[model samples]
Target: MPPCTTPNTTELVMIMDVESILHMKEGLGETSYSQNSSLQKKSTEAMKHFIIDSALAAYAFKTPEIFTIADLGCSSGINSLYLAEEIIKAIHERSRQLERLAPEFLVFLNDLPTNDFNAMFLSFPEFNMKFKAGIELQGGSAPSVYLAGIPGSFYSRLFPGNSLDFIYSCYSLHWLSQVPLGLLDSDCKPINKGNMYISNTSPPAVSLAYFKQFQKDFSLFLKSRSVELHFEGRIVILMLGRRTEDHSDKCTTVLWELLDQSLEIMVSQEIIDEEKVDAYNVPFYAPSAKEIKDEVHREGSFVIDCIQAYELSTSTGDPKEDARIISMAIRAIQESMISHHFGEAIIDTLFQIYSGLLSEFMVKEEIKSSHLLVILRKSC
Candidate 1:
């Protein structure tokens, strides 16, 4: 028999086609479920703003058949469905003023291969019923909405050129598909066996490493969006970022450092590997305004419709509750780490470290004010 051939990254990327990526987001085994009342409330409220803003922005497009929307990185949660409803209402109201036909919508629910689409599909029936009921109660035609799960990095694919009218991604992106190899060595060996970045404290070199990677990835994302978006399309990118008094360090990055220190204690106790600890990176990056501005300018595609930043407090008093939120918050980050390293054992240990740190951090101080919202529009 011919010598066995191991698959490389290129081959793996092919296998990870859109469908495979969707399955991954559906996650392994049964879909894990949770109800984050706080997150749900905040997310719903923020989404309303996006809906209204997007509707207003749609005026620039000025056509009923062209009205469309997509939720990039729409993981297995009720949020996407919620956004769909809000968008429909907002657009319908906007349409009335323009003397336009009731606009039909094409909504794309997207995420990675390792998400929980099954759970989201399971919830669709209820979503439809609720949406239809709401339309009837309002004495309006139920807007035609088509939902599809588009898998793969939102930075990539997302949609074909000029195919989308509006795009939204909440609490996602900022996840570099892979850690920067430069952070490791000339040999290109992975440093932390696949981590968010060596520790959350984000020492100078490591923090810079993450920023560079994000800038590169985000630049590509902007280029992709430029090509994929129609003239005057709108995109709402809402996620977590940090606020800081000192301008030297990126605010969101500083919060990551605090989280790192919390886990360093575990590293000292041998609960986690000190080397692996420093080698990882988070799926999310708390990007600075400067960084975001520079990237957008470099891409030269999107017009800065708006880039408002807000400081939101995310904290839970109880230890168990804190652990759950921390785990969920860092799920994508950790998964990115694991996929790069190629091991399940490390995943188990990372969770152990995360649990310990989350608990300690809860009593020690606070991990709030690292959340933000960013909205952009494709330049005419």
Candidate 2:
């Protein structure tokens, strides 16, 4: 047989395909998503009460014998299972309060096809046992719970019409289905050069491109879920966002700016070419609350139940430790894209430089990320 072959970084970047390449770092290794996702877990914990309340509300709305739920962008980590268990427990407790039989649950765990599902599946046995033991302690009948992985992008349809009762997604919507095509010119050259994302120095067109992509992708998301959800089905989404309407706000772009600074350092040191840095642009966007509300209203499928803004500090009172933790967390999420774009050789050095930059920045200023919690009910 001929030797195996795969596309190179340049080839992949030229096409601007994110769905084919975007995935968190896999497995249980030191740099794995499972190891470095404490930041995400913190965000989830902060919103845990809202998540539980939303699940209960959905359960109360439709007491179906087989209650179906889906967690979109369920990356490989214990956090995914943790959220699932929370929903299951909330619905189970609500059934107990009503003195009625609990509904059998069908929990769908969804993510990109390249996600490390095997790593997630390996931990299910332990999760299931712990879940059952907890239910046994409460002295109630164990409701049947089933989980199956669905590998695909959420920008498209994932389920049959009127099949889902509830849906939950966290920290995943900021990623565009693909890098916005408007980022390129007629010559197919990157317009937002020397910056990995929307930045203070980027031109007006760059910000507009990012916003337009968000509008298109988010609208498609609502439309697809509208088809998949039962009437009045509920969705709880928590994702990275900004407090202001401006796309280049520091609250959202600081992390990417720091990463870009690190890449510039490498370019100055002649470790990587300047052109290489200029060619790369991150396929991510952090929207403002107003933007989200507008999109939901324009989509006309879901009525906004709640939309709130929250902040999570990336500080631990020690700048160095905070830098390490924050850099690791970002690496776990963005390494796949960065490595694919710049090659795997610079992974270690890049993050090391990033950590140092973050350390210095943290000592001068406290870094916090803004998040948006949106609860929508299918109304059309």
Candidate 3:
């Protein structure tokens, strides 16, 4: 092979397969997402009303013989399996209402190839046993529950035609399939300096590029699911989103802005390259409700059933504790990618600065993260 040359921003964004970095840092240990995902748990709880209702609509109205459910971006531990159980609860309740045996279930847990499937697989025995016991306690035979891990990106089709009844994804679709192309300026230099993602400082071009990429990726996502979903099938998506159409909105990218602040401090101390900071763009987007609705309409497959926005806050009156919790959560999600670029050496120092920045941010004002819950149906 030719001498390995470090790829520039343009080449890096193009050639980097998301599966290489899309996974949660693995396992059930402290550094793992399993231990530090309380924020995501809160998101699921807030969206529970929407999830159960949509899942029930699929079961009661469409009532497939072999009910299929998919939990896209099913990362490690309790949350991943938790969704399966909630889905089962929806199926069981509908079955009870109809006065019939619960339909057999084929549940697919989907994530990137590098995701910690073993953590989920290891939890299977308890997941199924407890679920079955719960059914018996209700004086009904256990519904046949089958589990499979579908390892791939959701931007593409992962199942056959009309194969799904209810599809669910939580806190995941914000990730783009790849970095948006053309982050360079008219001068062919990186425009988004010091920030890993969209911030108040980002140029108009950067915001437009990210939003357009989301429109493209999200449209493809809908189109792929459109083919896989049965008539009237329902999909419930709950993820971090922006309340405003403006991509540069502060609340939408709050955590990232803090992260940017951390890196900027490091650059000021000459710890990491200012140029490297400028070159790196995180592959994530927080779409507005209007953006999502427009994409669903443009895809012409899924009709919006409902859209709800909730506030996620880490403010606890005490700044240090808030920073610790938020930093741990951020470390779990982005450590792998950050390590890849900045090396493992800076991990500790980075999050120390990250925590300090977050603490300062909380002291200034309360931070309420915006999360959007969208329910859609396959157009008949």
- Best candidate (score: lDDT): 2
The worst-scoring run of ten residues by lDDT in candidate 1 lies at: 22-31
The Cα RMSD in angstroms, rounded to one decimal, for candidate 3 relative to the true structure is 3.3
Over the stretch 1-380, how does candidate 2's per-residue lDDT look in tens digits? Answer: 43224323453564456887899999999999989999889999989998888788878887889989899999987798988898898898888889888999999999999999998888888888888888998887678889899999898999999999999998899998877656655555666788989998998878997899889999999999999999888999999999988888888999999999999999998889987887788778899889999999998999999999889898889999999999999999999988887899999999999999999999999999999999999998
Put down candidate 1 lDDT per residue, 222-315, tens digits, no spaces. Answer: 8887888788888777765545423234435433554466456556767566665554444345676667777888888777766656765556
Q: lDDT of each structure?
A: 0.61, 0.88, 0.85
Q: Clashes per prediction? A: 24, 0, 0
Question: Candidate 3 on 1-380: residue-level lDDT in tens?
Answer: 44333446543753375567767878878878999999899879877878988888888876766889999999987788887788787788778888887888999999999999988899999989998898889887888889999999999999999899999999999999987776775566677878788887888878887888898899889999999998989999998898787787778887898898889899999999888778777789999888888898877887899987777777778988888888999999998878877778999999999988888878888888898999999886
- Taking every candidate in turn, the Cα RMSD to the unseen true structure, in Å, is 5.8, 4.7, 3.3
Q: Model 1, residue 338: displacement in angstroms?
A: 4.7
Ranking by TM-score: 2, 3, 1
TM-score, one value per model: 0.78, 0.95, 0.95
RMSD of 2: 4.7
